[model samples]
Target: MTVNLLYSITGLLIFFMGICGLMFHRSLVRQTLALNIAGAGIFLFLVAQAYKSDTVPPDPVPHGLVLTGIVIGASATALMLFLIGVHQSVSKSSNDEGERGS
Candidate 1:
């Protein structure tokens, strides 16, 4: 009934969905998206918990943490994509070389 409860429930759902996606999907892109979804859910839960009441100010610590988390998540995703690109390029080149040799 409460806003906090609703946020918590939503966050849990998103987090679980992400986990399921990660477990079931074979594609690298999908797995990366799942990780981002899980991170967002964690941020949502933290922010929701930091809320005291309508009149009281929310805690700043959670906000700071969430920002840090976002940065880290972005960096990780970028790195993963870069690695995937490098791997694909290497594989392609190797395949091409093999074809030329034969």
Candidate 2:
């Protein structure tokens, strides 16, 4: 089998793992991490496909796209974390206020 094929297969497995993690975990952070892992798998798969056996180096187009994807994913993850933190803080404060009023 070709190296690209192997990489694609591995990427698929990792992607599935991330999906399972998201489905099974109750915590928001865990779900975000799972999404990140899935994103990584997709990047790896794309890079693998762009790799040419005849060429010493891989295509630049896929690399650029993967890099952009990584940056976007990073921003998205930060926003998700921030949102989760805000939600948790608000929920805690509200519960505390309710208890005090009771």
Candidate 3:
């Protein structure tokens, strides 16, 4: 009923969905996307938990941590996508070379 409880439940659900996607999908890109989803859920949960008191201001530490996590997650996702592209290109080139040789 409370906002924090709702957010916590929603975050957990999203995180679980991501885990399921990661487990079921075969493609690296899909898995990467799932990982990002999970990270977002975690960040949301942290943000929700940061505000316990209605009168006092929300804690800045968790917000700062979430911001840092988002940056790192974005960087890691970009790196993963780039690597996946490289892998696909290399695989394609090798297949093409094989076909030509044969």
Q: How much lDDT does each candidate structure score? A: 0.93, 0.92, 0.94
TM-score per candidate: 0.95, 0.92, 0.94
Candidate 1, residues 1-102, lDDT tens digits: the string is: 899989988988899989999999999989999999998899899899889999999999999999999999999999999998998999999999999999
- Of 1 and 2, the candidate ahead on lDDT is 1
Better of 1 and 3 by lDDT: 3
Instruction: Please give, for residues 52-78, the per-residue lDDT of candidate 3 as tens digits.
Output: 878989989999999999999999999
Q: Model 2, poorest ten-residue lDDT window?
A: 50-59
| TM-score of decoy 3 | 0.94
lDDT score at residue 68, model 1, on the 0-100 scale = 97
What is the per-residue lDDT of model 2 for residues 36-60, given as tens digits with 9 covering 90 to 100?
9999888888889888887577788
Provide the lowest-lDDT 10-residue window in model 1: 8-17
